[model samples]
Structure formats: C-alpha cells, structure tokens
Target: MGGSSLRRLNARLVTVGVLLVLAWGGIGYRLVVVQALEADVYADHGLDQRLQREILAADRGTIFDRDGRELAVTVDSVTFYANPSEIEDPTTVARLLAPLLHQNMLDVLDAISGEGTFAYVARQLERDDADRVIAARLPGIYYFTEPKRVYPMGELTGHVIGFVQADDNQGLEGLEYQYDDSLSGVPGELLVERDPHGRTIPQGEYQVVPAEPGSDLVLTIKTEIQFAAAEALQRAIDRTGAKGGSIVVVDPATGEILAMVNLPTFDPNDRSDADPAAFRNRAVTDVFEPGSTQKVITISAALEAGIADPDTIFEIPTTIERGETVFRDSTTHPSELTVTGIVAHSSNLGTITLGEMLGAKELHRNLYAFGLGQPSGVDFPGEASGLLRPSEEWCAVNCVASTSIGYGVSVTTLQMAMVYATVANDGVWVQPHLVKEIVDGKGTRVAVEPLQRRVIDAATALSMRLMLEEVVSGGTGGYAAVAGYRVGGKTGTTEKYLIDEQRYSEDDVVASFIGMGPIDEPRVVVAVVLDSPRQDDSGGKGAAPVFAEVALAALHQLGVPPDDR
Candidate 1:
C-alpha cells in the first residue's frame, strides 16, 4: 500500500515539472524573436515616431545699387510653429501665446487646435519679440530662424528693386520677381529627434546640411539720379495736377538705365495696404502715343533715307486735308519752313509730306529701324514693343498722315527715350538693361554686355542732334533747356487713350518730353511722361521742366562739364 502511494505522488510531481519546462521554453523563444529576429523593424518604428525632418531655408541674395549700396537685404527673423497634435488644451496654450504673437486669441486657437502634427503660429517676428514668446515655455509651440527681406532704401528704390513675399521671401514684383531663381539659393536639410511635447531631444540623432547663399545682383541704377528724378516727377504731378508720371534716365552709349522713377510708388518694406496696381514699372510696361516727341525719329529717318536734309524746305500749311481727317500742327507755323523748322515747330503736314516721299514701306522700315513697333529687349520684364502696325495693315487713307505725326501708333516711354538715345549714341541702338553685373558666391563676376545695332548713319544722327538742339533752344521744347548745358529734345502731347472705353479721352492727355544733353558730346537721355494732366496739359508746359531738372541733376552727377555757350 505504501509503495503504490509513493508511485502515484511521484507521477503527479513529474507531470508538474514537465508543464513548467514547456512554459519556460515558450517564454525564452518569444524573447529571442523580439530581441534578435525582428529587432531592427521594432527599433526603426520607435525611432520614426521621435524623428523630425526640417527645412533649412537658404539665405536670399543681396541686391546692390551700382555704387554698392544695399537695396534689398535678408535679416534674421523668427518663424513660430507648433505640434498641434501634441498640444494639450489648445485654447489655454493659444491664450498664453496670443498676446505675445500679436494675434487674436481665436485665431491662435484655430492655428493650434488642428489635429495635424505641424502648424504655423506666426511668422517673421523680430528676434527680441521672438525671445519673449520663447520665455513663455508653452507646450507644443516651437520657433525657427527665417530670413526676412528688407528694403533699406524704402520707397525710393521700391519700384525698381521691388519687394518679396512675406513668409517665404519669394520675389513678387519688379526686379524681385524678374530674377527670383537667381536670388533664391539652394535649401538644405535638417534631421533631428524631438519629444512629443515639441522639445528637441538632447544628443539624439542631430544632422544638418548647411545652406548655400545666393548670387548677388549689381544694378546700374544711380541712387542720386533716381532720387532727383522721383522728386522732379512728383513736383510735375503736383504742378500739373496729373494723376501719375514716369521718368527714365539712360546712358545712351551703354544703354544703362541710370534712373527710372515712376509715381504712385510705395514703400516695399511695409506693404500692409499697398495697391497691386502700383507694382508695375510703368516706364517699361505702359504705352502711349508719343505725340511730337516721335518727330525725332521721323526727322532722323528722313535724313537717314537722304529723302530730306535738315535744311530741305517744305510747304508747312497750318492745316492739310488728308482723307476725312485734316491733319494740323498743335501750333501754327510758317506756310513753308525748312525741314529743321518743321521738326523744331513739330509740323504734322510737313512730316506727312516727308512720309509721302519716303512711302509707307520705307516709313515703316525706318520706324522699325529707329526701335519702334518692337520690344526694346530690355532686361526688364514686360517691356511693351510699342504698337506699330505692319505697312500692309496700315489703312491707305489716313495711316500715313496719322502715323507720320505720332498717331495711329503706340510707344513706351523707355522705347521713345531710346529713340533720342539712339541719335545721341551716334545712330547706334544699344539694348537697354538695368543690371550691370551678377556676382556669384564664389566671387566670380559676369558683366551684362548690351547688344548694339546701327539705326542710322553717324552723320545723320549728328544732323538730327543739331536739329533737336533747335527744338530746345528756339522751338517747342524750349522749357526742356538745362541751365548750364546745350540740350536737345522734342515735345509730345497726345490725347490719352482710355482702355475701358476704347477711345481717346477728350479732356486727358499724355504730356511728354524726351531729351539729351551736351549736344556735341551727348551723355544723358531723359524721358518724362505725365498722365491725365488737369492743368498745363501740353508737353511744353507739363513734361519739359521735369526733363530739365532730371537732366541737370544727372549731368552734374556724371561730372559732365557745361558746354561753352
């Protein structure tokens, strides 16, 4: 009986020991699978949950005036971001950060209440202000350094230097938009480990690829000249009661835009209430009938064709009937005047007579040669190739008379300026450009070489220059005379064409004067256009004085000595 009891107890003990061994074996196998077989997969999953990738914005390139003055620059600014999913009680967090960020509490709440992991709280805060927000120690809120675009010259260079987007610093208008890619550099990458509360994990998976800076642009714009032109234009607008205006100063020899000013300008630094309409560089973008300022081209073309010399005489009637339109000069002239007198007095019939001799195709060819009816091919964006219809498209009845007298055509201020500039440059039309050179981060410099083409013979250009001198010295452009220099120019006054109504406004006119200085050795060419002048509506009274002021300032700035009287 004792042996049987012992055997049964031993069997029970053996059963319990076997079950314990099996359980231990299963536990050990499971541990091996988790720690060795699939260890890499589980480890990677845990790391991804803590890992963060960030973009390191590249430093935008600097914009410099011809004399190395900074126009546009990038400065250190703060951009605040948040981990919305990690934020506990978004309403409370928003209330704490709202006042510091200068944002409405509700707006802040909406920004932080998102279920997404990332959100922007505010952008582009000054460093001192950003530090104050950091001191608050709010959970889920984070900050990073972003570059802010600043125009130091303010509204003075705003039209030409242009402004950028607030958040990304992307170029939006003017030169900023024109050269965006060259200005925006390559961005870098950042990898870091962060805790769920938006705090960077110390000594955990930090990496960085430093960003490269963008190339810099050196412009041909002279600051002193730009300021003078702007001031003079503003005064013209005030005196003439004109809505707006544009002034362009160029170096005819090099086609360098010395100073380009457009009114209704704005401060690029603070664009809180800026009108988008004012963003256009009107000197390059807007077009108008050049009126008699185009006479320079017409007279130059006639001389180039050898159809009429400056001394050639023509029957200059006060009114000449052509088709239904009786073409007439704005001011009465002698019944018969020399070619020079016709140009000096700006006679419509006299120029039409020359146009008849030159013929339509020859006239069109000459106008095209003088840089009309085509884009000036300036480095500037949106340059209007003044509207010139093909000779075949010209209505046989009135196109010749109207076009010869600066009507039935359109031209940009810059385009017409270059016409006089062409004559000033010895009949050579050099491609216009604002930028002088581009400098890369490596210190390599590339100069912008403008294209040049001969529009007329040097002799013809010289003859036209002398004739234009008469216009300023004794004729219609007398008001454009500079105080100490021998200047030559033409007056232009055209009825303003209303785009919406598709007709010329009876009351408003575009008054313009384009001129060059030191006639024998031309240096500067200035073009002024005043729009919709309520008073002093003629180019002689409205736009010529602007030319005088800008030309004198430019000549003095260039150190061009006054011509011996």
Candidate 2:
C-alpha cells in the first residue's frame, strides 16, 4: 500500500532468492561427493555389512609308529554349533539334534537356551550324524567341517601320542603338544556375503583362501614291543595289585625309544571323563629313588676315575652310619667283596666306600654327563629334569653316602634306562627321543640326530656290563634274565616319597628293574617301574619279571640272536 513497504517486500524476496541459490549449491556438492568422488569407498562400506569372514581350519598331521602303523590320525569330522539368540525354538531344535548327536535332549536344551551367540551342541560328530542334523535344518544351528584327532591304539599308546582339543584341534598333551607348531599348519580365511537373516546371499561375493595342511610325524615306537610292554605291565598290575606301572625300552646304540608305556593310561579318543592324572607319561614326567639300580653309575664312576675296577676289593661293614642315618645291606653278605661282588650283592657299604673315592663333585659331574639331573632332551612334552641338587650341597651329612646307595638321588624310568643304555652303548650317553622323523606338507623330511657324549670310557662300560650281567645271573636281579640271551640289569625298590605330605611313605614303595639284553652287543634296554605293589612288591620279584617279559619280546621282535649257546 505504501512505497516504503513495497521496497521492503522486494528486498525480502531478493534475500529469499539468494538463500535458495546457496542451498542448491550445497546440495549439488553433496550429490557430487555421494555419486562420484567417494563412491567406491561408500560401496565398499555397504558391502562390508553383508561380508562375513570365516577361519578355515587346516588339516592336522598323522602320527605313525616305527613300523608305519597309524598310532594317531586325523579324519574329516563335523561339529554343530548354535546361536541361541538366533534360534527360533531351542526346545524343538534340541529335540531334533539330541538323538542324532547322541546327547541328552535336556543337555542340548540347556546349551542352546542362553542368549549367547555361540554354543557347542556336539563336537567331532560323524558324517552320518552330521548329515542327519543338516536334514533337520534347525534354524540358528550352524556347522562346518573340522578335524577330530583319533588314536588307533587306544590306551595302548595313550600316554605317548596324546590327544588334541575336539573343536579347534589344538594339541593338549604328549608328543602332540611337543611339536604343535610343526603339526598345526597355517590357517586360511573364507569370505562370504550374507543377508539380513544370516543366509548366504545368492550370487553374493565369495572367496576362499586355502589352508596349508600340517606336517606328519613318525615315531620310533615299535608296535610289537609297545604292545608287549603294555600287556606285561597290565598283567603286573593285576598280579601285584599295584597302583600302576611304566616300561621304557630303547635302542642302546641310537637313543631311539622302542617302546614306552605307562599304566593308568586313558583313551585319547574321547577324554570327556578321563582323569587328568592318566595323561601323565610317568617314565618321563615322574621320578623315584633308584635304590640298587643306581649302583652301576657309582661303580662306573669309580672305574672311570681309575679309583676301582670290577675286581677291586673293599671291606664292607654290616652297618655304616653317617650323621644320624644308618645304612645296611638288604640281605646278609660276606664282610669283604670285590667291586663286581659288591654290585652283584647290591652292598650299600661297598657302594659308599667307592663313592668316597670319587667324592660328590666328580659323581655329580658324571651323573650330569649321563643325562641325569637334567631333561633327557626327549622330543615328548612335559619331560622332567629330575631332582639333582648342586654337588656342593651334598657334602653335608650322609648326602654322599645316601646318593651312593641310591637313597637320596631320584630318577625317571627313561633316565635310568638311558643310564644302562650308556653302559650298553660302550659308555656313550645319548639323548633319548621318540620321534624318528617328521615329514611336512612341503615334503621336507626332518630326521632325528640325537645328541651324544661319552659318559665313561669303553673299557669301563665293558666292565660295567659284565658286572650287571653278574646281577641277573647270580644276584638280586635274577628274575630279569631273558631266555636265550645274556642279559644284564639292576633291581631297585625305594620308599615312595609323598610330595603332598613332604615325607616318605612307610608302606608304599616303588619297585623297578632296569636291564639290557644280548650283553656282548647289547641291543635292547628296558626299564620297568611298578608303583606300590602289595604282593611281589620288591624290584627283584615284581619289576624284574616284567622286565624279562618285555626284554624277551623286544629282542625277539628286533630279530636279535640269543647268546645262550
């Protein structure tokens, strides 16, 4: 209506037009960014929401015995998993899977009940069962191919080969754990584009990066010898009413273990209810006082130091005292005995006298050189170094005397077997090992070259072998003699040390016998250890018989000629 008002309205309209132009410019800039400049990045981001990356499992290796028999192996297996949150009806799904999975419906229901995204309904299922689960097509239940470790020998080689985890197939114990890296090859990845409901989209982006398979292991275990040892040990347990036992057989010249078995073993196939204690390989992991079986080391030490020979004479007192401890021979013997006679009789005073000649430091050094006081450098996992304190610590009280008589020192069955193996191998100490070779997926071969060192001179070893022969022929180890073979060995029985109580058990004892057969060219060394036998409890009676059984079988299996003629 007024001239001033008309001018104001035109100015407002111009301002509005400028505002619209700026808004359009900003919109064009945004459109260019979304359509062209960052288009690839945005497209990738959107696709990422649908893309799923999955870990592809590698195939585990196989374990073979010396004879190429499959001791442990892996096969294709199926595992069914579920996302409880995604499950439409847990009860119905559980019901469908229970019978096929061989699991209780209630247990399955509980596993699939929670809001968690993942739960294992059943692991390591067979193809038939897995196929049945697939046919059910229960929502939220997912499955993919996974490996399952199996032991063909069952409890026969349980403690040695060990087992792996069911789902991830990770090594859990024994040689499997020892060489996990070599056995577990590189894993791969799989990319899959999925829809909103977690379905694989049709014609969606999919790619697979292949997994490299693991290496295979070949052990030194002779199946025949292993079976013989296992059977003998089991019979020994039954006859003696013993808690358990262990047997170790080795090739004296090569340091390769032939047979290693432990009782109280569990099946590695399915360890759902297996006691963890059954997993221990006692020959390598546990230790015990060696008793008279250790006399060889002392005698060999004396011979090595030129302090005594097999015929060297010592006057043995009936009872000898060091500090408050008084030591006596297990059985009555003459007042004086030559070194050979002393070993045969297992004279405590005689051994102590010889130990005084070598002293503690030299003895400890020799023992360490023999692979005691340290791990045997075995290829198996969880090997113990055994208990050998520093030599300087032994000068106090009757430590030296106790050690000489095999009361203070402790050793594993494998260690003791290796000790006798040294004497059998012309006084050379070699690192004992179970794995003979490992072949990888790349066709690379890994052969075992065991460590070797001379523990004693060849002459001393000859003398020690002769002295041990006398033990089996006329002494406490009479039961350890192998038929048609000139065998040599030592017997040991010691009070069981109770670690939990920090004391020795008055009643329980560890009975053991370690021996080698075909004495002139000793081929086999076997160590038998029985735990807490009530009847036939002494080493000579309980463990020696087992040693004979195993040694004979091993010798025969190796096609060794008998020297009885």
Candidate 3:
C-alpha cells in the first residue's frame, strides 16, 4: 500500500518538473529572437523617441553703399515657440506672453492649445521683449535666435533695396529679389537627444552642422548724392504739383550709378501700410517719350556721321510739314540756326529735318547704339526695355517724323541718363551697374566690371558737349546752369499719349532734363523726369531747375573743381 502511494506522488512531481523545464526553454528562445534577430529595428525605434533633428537658420548677408554705409543689414531676433503637449495652463501662459509679444491673449491661448505638438507663439520679437519673456521662464515656452532684415536708412534707398516677405523671409521685390541666391545663406542641421521630461540630455549624443552665412554686397551708390537727388526731385514735384518723378546721377567715366531715386517710394522695412504704387522703381521701370531729349541722340548721330558740326547751318522754319502732319517748335523760330543752336533751342522742326536726312535705318542704329530700346543691365528687377520699332517698321512717314521729335518712341529715365553719360565719357558707352563687389563670410572680395562699348568718336563727343553747354548757358535750359560751374544739358517736354483716347493728351506732359557738367571734362551725368506737371511749367522752367539743384550738389559732393572758378 505504501509503495503504490509513493509511486503516484513521484509521478505527479516528475510531471511538474517536466512542465517547468519546457517553459524555461521557450523563454530562452524568445530572448534570442528579440535580442539578436531584431536588434537593429528595436534600437532605431528607441532612438526615435530620444533624438531630435532640427534645422538651424543661416544669417543673411548685409548690403552697403560704396562708402561702406550700411543700407540693408541683418540683426539677431528672438522667435517664440511652444510645445502644445507640455503647455499646461494655456490661459496663464498666453496672458504672460501677450504684452511681451504684442499679441492677442486669446490668439496666443489658441496657439498654445492646438492639437499639434509644436506651434509658433510669435516670430521676430524685439530684444527687450524677448529678454522679458526669458525672465518669465514659462513652461513649454522656448525661443531661438533668428536673423531679421533691417533697413537702417528707412526710405532713403527703399526702391533699390526692396523688401522681403515676413512669413518666409523671402525677397519679393527690387534688388533683394534679384540677388536672392547670393543673399540667402546655406542652412545647417542640429541633432540632439532629449530625456523623458523633454529636456536636453546632459553630456549626451549631440551633433551640429554649422551654417554658412550669405555673401555681402557692396553697391556703387553714393549715399550723400542719393540724398541730394531725392531731395531735389521731391522739391520739383512739390513745386510743379506733379504726380511723381525720378532722378538718376551717374559717374560717366565708369558708368557707376552714384544715385537713383524715385518719388512716391515706400519704406522697405515697414511695408504693411505702404501703397503698392509706391513700390515701383520708376527710374528703370517707367517709360516715357524723351521729348527734346531725343534731339541729343539725333544731333550726336549727325555729328558722328560727318553730316554736320556745331557750326553747320540749317534753315529752321517755324513749322515743318511732313505729309499731312505738322511739326512745330515750342516757340516760333523762322531764322537759320547752326547745329549747336538747333540743339540749344530744342527745335522740333530742325530735329525732324535731320532725321529725314539720316533716314530710319541709320537713326535707329544710332539710337540702339546709345542704349535706347534696351535694358540698362542695372542689376535691378523689372527693368523695362523701352518701346522702339525696328527700322523696317518705320515705313510710315509719320513714324519717322514722330520718332524724330520723341513722340512715337519711348525710353526709361535710366537709358536717357546713360546716353548723356556716354557723351560725357567721351563717346565710350559704359554699361550702368548698381553692385560694386561681392564679399563672402571669409572676407574674400570679388569685383564687378561693367560692360563697355564705343558709341561715337571722342572728337564727336567733345563737340556734343560743347553744343550741350550752349543749351545751359543761353538756350532753353538756361535754368540748368549751376553757379561756379560750366553746365551742359538739354530740356525736354513731351505730351503723354492717352491710352483710352488713343491720342496724345494736351494737358498730360512729361518734363525732363538730361545734363553733364564742366564741358571740358565731364564728371557726372544726371537725368530728372517729372510726370504731368502744370501746363505752364515746361521742361525749361521745371526740370531744368531740378537738374541745376541736383547737379550742383553732386558736383560739390564729388569735390569737382568749378570750371567757372
């Protein structure tokens, strides 16, 4: 009986021992599958929870004038961010951040309570305000340094500097948009680990790829000259009760633009309340019939082709009849005038006669060589290649007559200025340019060379300067004479064509003056253009005065010795 009972108990014990051994073997097999076969997959999954990859912004470059004055620059700013998941008491956090960020408390609260893990509370905060926020040390709130584009001179160079979009910091207009690639820097990367509490792990795995800052731009603009031109243009607009105006001052020798200004310009820094119309850089963007200014080109062509000289005499009737069209001067002059006298008086009759002699092909070729009907290659955005019909298209007799008087053809103020600049540069046409050099973060500098070509002989250019001097000294552009200096210039007034009426408007005229100084050795070429001035104010009375004011100031600023003195 005892043996039977013992045997039953032993069998039960053996069954329990066998079951335990099987269970242990199954657990060991599972450990090998997880630890060895799937080790890499589990390791990556764990790292995903602890490691964070972030984009680091690179600082944008600075823009400076030729004199090293900062025009556009980058400054450090604070960007406020929040982790919505960790933001407890969103109402309290929003209330504290509202005054510091200049934001609505309700909006801030909504942002912090969003379903997303991260949200922007405020972007580009002022340093003082950011400091205050940092002192507050609100949970789930964080900040990082960001680069903000700032225009220190405000509207002084707004047209050329242009502005950027706040949302993505992308350039939208002007030089900013045209040179975006050089101005925008290469971004970097940041890799770091975090703990369970969402804090950076101390002495843990971290990596960084440093950002490469953008290259700096050096412009050919002279800030002082720019200011003077802007002031003079504004005064002219105010005096004439004109809609708007533009002025361009250039160094004839190198074709470096000293100043380019347009009235009704907007401040690049704060464009939220600016008018869209003010954003246009009229000097390069707007086109108008050059009026009497075109006569300079015609006279230049005639002089260069051996057809005439300063003393070449021609009978200038009061009115010229070409087919059915009648062309008359601003004033009646029935006497004979020399080539110099014709340009000085800005006679439409004489100019049209010269155009007939030159014919359309030769005239068009001369105009093209002078940079008309082409972009100035100014490194600016939205430059207009003014309206110019090919010689073949000038079959109509009216086309030749109208173009001779600057009626049918159109040109930008920059092109007109460059034309005079070529004459001042002894007939060598230098391409107008804005940028002077490019400098990288490592202090490497690369210079920009402007394009150049010969438009006329040096002797012809000298003769043109002498004839232009006659204009300022005694002719229609007398008001353009500067004190203590010998001035050379031409006055222009043209009626604007009405798009709706399909004819030229009698009241709407563009008044302009193109000039150079010290006829012996010209230093600067300036062009002033005003739109829709009072009918009583012709180019001689309106634009010439502005030209004198700006040209005088420019001469003084450039330290040019007065020729009169």
Candidate 4:
C-alpha cells in the first residue's frame, strides 16, 4: 500500500507542474501579440491621470507683393487651451479669464467645467495678451505658439490677394486660389511628452520634424497703379451715383494685367463685416452686353475680309427692320454715311448692315478671335466663361441682325479689354496673366512670361486702330481724351435686360468704355464699367470720363513720355 500511494502522488505532482508551465507559455504568447503586433489597437490612448504624448504644430508661411512688400504675412501668436477635468475651481478660473478674454463668464465656466480633458480657451491671441493671461495664473489654462496672417496695406489689393479662413490656411479667392498649390506647403509634426500637470517636460525625449512653410507669389499688379485706378473709378462711381463699378488696366505689349479692381472691395484683414459682393473681381467675373464697344469687331472683320472700306458709302437712314426686330441708330441718321462714319456715330442700323455683309459665321469667327466665349485664363478663381449661344442656335434674320449690333450675347470686361489690347499689340492675342513669379518654401523662384498667339493680321489691326481713333475724336468716345496723346476708344451703353431664371429682355442700362492711348505706339489698354449709372446720358458721359481720368493718372504715374511725334 505504501509503494502504490507514493508512485501515484509523484505522478500527480509532475502532471501539475507541466500544466502550470503550459499555461504560463500561453499567457506570454498572448501578451507578445497584443503589445507587438497590435500595440496601436490596444494602447491607443493615455489614461486620465497618466502622462501622454502631444503634437507641436509648425509655423505657417507668408505672402509678399510684386515689389517685395508685405501683402500678407504670418505672425507668431499663442493658442490657449484648457484641461476642464483638471480645474479645481471652475468659477474662480472663469471669473479671472472672462475679463481678460472679454468672453462671457458663464461660457468660460462651462468650458472649464466640462468632462473633456482638453478644450480651446482662446486661439490666435497676440503675445502680449497671451502673456497677460499666463500671468493671471488661471487654473488649467495653457497656450502654445500659433501663426496668424496679417495684411500690411489693408484693402489696397484685397480683391487681388484674397483672405484665408479661420481653420483653412489656403486661399479662398483671387490669386490665392489661382496659385494655392505652390503657396501651400506640407505641415510638419512634433511628438511631445507631457507630465501629470499637462505641461511638456523640457528634458523629456522629443521627436520633432520642422515644418516647411508655404511658398510666396509675386503678381504682375503694380500697387501704385492699382491704388490709382481704384481711386479714380471710385470717384466716378460716387459722382455718377452708380450702384457699382469696375476697371482693368493691361499692358498692350505683353497682356500683363497691371491693375484690376472693382468698387466695394473688401479688406482681407477684417472680412467679418464685408459684403459678399465686395469679394467679387468684376473685371473677369461679371458678364454684360458689350454694346458699341463690340463694334470694333465688326470693323476689324470687315476690314480683314475686304467686304467694305472706311470710305465705302452706305445710305444709312434711321431705322431698319429685319424680320420682327427693328434696329435703329441712337440718333436720326442721314441717308448717306461712310463706313467710317457709321462706326463713329455708332449707328445700330449701319452696324447691322455691315455685320450682315460679313455673315453670321464670319462675325462669330471675329468674336472668337477676339477672345470671347471662353475663360480669359487670368490668375483668379470663379472667373466665368460668359454666355455665348452657339451660332447653331441663331434664329435666322433676328438673331443674326442682333448679333451684328452687339446684342443677344454677353461678355466680360476683361474680354473687352483684350480686344483693344489685341489691336494695340498689332493683332497678337497674348494670354492675360496675373502671377509674375512663384517663390518656393526654400526661397527659389520660377518666373512667368507672356503667352503670345496671333489672332489677326497686322494690316487689319492698323486699319482698326484708325477707326477707333475716329471713335475717340469724332464718334461716341470723344469724352475719353488725353490732351497730348493720340487717344482712341469706344463707348458702350447697353440696355440691361430684365430676366427670369429662363429668359431676358432689355430695360435697364450698363454704361462702359474701352480704349487705348498714345495711339502712335500704344502701351496700355483700359476698360471701365459702371453698372446702372444714374444721371448720365450714355457710356460716352458715364464711363468715358472715368477711363480718361484713370488713363491720364496711369500715364503720369508711369512717367510715360507724351507722344510729340
């Protein structure tokens, strides 16, 4: 009995030992898998009282103007945050911070007494203000370095250089949107170890990868020219009691936009109180009936096709009927007026007759050649291609006749400027551009150049120039005169159409002027648009004066020598 009992007890002891070892091995394997293969899944967070890791955000980039002037820049600031769960006395802390932040005490207390471990107390506070808040010793409140964008020139080029939003660092409009890719850089990261007090330990192990700030953009706009154009256009708008106004100045040689502005422009600094319309860049964005400014196309086409010469006589009377539509001159016309006279007088009857001789297809070719019915490709967002019904949609005689006289269609002021610029540039269609250069995050620059494409013959351009000269000297655009320069341009006072969501018909008016000057060797092309001008007869009176005033100012500012030739 003794031998059997001893053997059984020894065996039982060995089996128990083996079972314990197997259990220990199984637990060790499970722990290894959980910690190594699935560490991120299981250990994703830090507990309420334990120290944890946090991130330090990198600095954002800055923006500068063409002349290396600070248009927009980021300044170092602080963002205040609170650990609501750590605050001992929420009411006391709120009372101290509410006045410092100018926030409601109740709101502050609510933020501090919440169940969350962290919440924003204040963001983008200046250094001085942040220091004051830090000195107050408010419980559970802390701050870190932040970047805020500031505009040095206020609203000077606000329309061109758009504003950034609160959360998003990229541009929302204008050249900002146009060149956002080059301007926006990748954000950097920082791994910071925090203690129980929610403060970073200076000696703690930290992993920091410095941030690369965004690139800088240099635009073609001249600040002084921009300011001058804005002031002059604004003055005209005020004097005429117009609802709104727009002006664009372009280098006729290269098609570089020097100044483009729309009245009621906003200040990018404080955008909260600005009207939505103030953000719109009307020169390239807003479309309207071009009226007589479009007559240049007809004359150019006629001259190009040799359908009629300037001296060719047409017995243009008053009104002429085509199908159901009756086209008439602004004033009664004589029985006989030369082709040049019809252009000078802006005779609707005469224009329609000439346009008809060119035919619809030929007329459309001329308009398309002039850069109509497509995006101007300017460096700005939200630019419209404008409304141009295909020639296939033309309703026989009525549509063709109206199209001839600059009706039944819409175009942007930028497009109108291009027509004059093309003539001034001897018929070369250069793509309009705003950005002159792009500077990368590493301070490297890539320059831009003019994209030239010829659209008409040199002979046609010269002939058209002479006709436009007639417009400024003896025709509707006479008011846009420079005393010493060989000024030439056109006037357009189109009836603003009343429309529903589907259709439109004429009732109101949008007065505008398109011109180029020192015609002997043209340098600049400018166009001014006054929407719904009050107390003016036509574009000749409402818009021509504005164009002349701006052109004169621009010439004087640029020190462009007067043409004594």
RMSD of each: 3.5, 4.7, 3.4, 6.1
CA lDDT scores, all candidates in order: 0.89, 0.90, 0.89, 0.81
On the 0 to 100 scale, the lDDT of residue 329 in model 3 is 80
TM accuracy, model 4 = 0.83
- Model 3 worst lDDT run, 10 consecutive residues: 326-335
**Mind sharing the TM-score for model 2?**
0.87
Candidate 2 local lDDT, 1-565, one digit each (tens)? 9999999999999999989988998899988999899999899998999999988888788899988899888887888889999988889988888887888999999999987799988777878778988898889998977777878899899999888876577888998888889899999999999999999998999999999989999999999999999999999999999999999999999999999999999999868798999899999999898888888898899998999888878889988898898988896778989999998888888999998778899888887888778888899887888888889987577888988878777889999999999999999988899999999998898998999998889999999999999999998889998889999999888889998998999999999999998899999999999999999989999999999999999999999988866
> Which one wins by lDDT: 1 or 4?
1
- Which lDDT value does model 1 have at 3? 95
> Which pairs of residues collide in candidate 4?
496-508
Quote the lDDT for 18 in model 2: 89
Displacement of residue 356 (Cα, Å) in model 3 is 1.1
TM-score (all chains, Cα) for each model: 0.89, 0.87, 0.89, 0.83
TM-score of 3: 0.89
Worst 10 residues of 1 by lDDT: 313-322
Model 3 sits at a Cα RMSD from the real structure of: 3.4
Query: Candidate 4's error at 420, in angstroms?
Result: 1.4
- Cα deviation at 308, candidate 4, in Å, is 2.3
lDDT of 4 at 241: 82
Pairs that clash in candidate 3: none
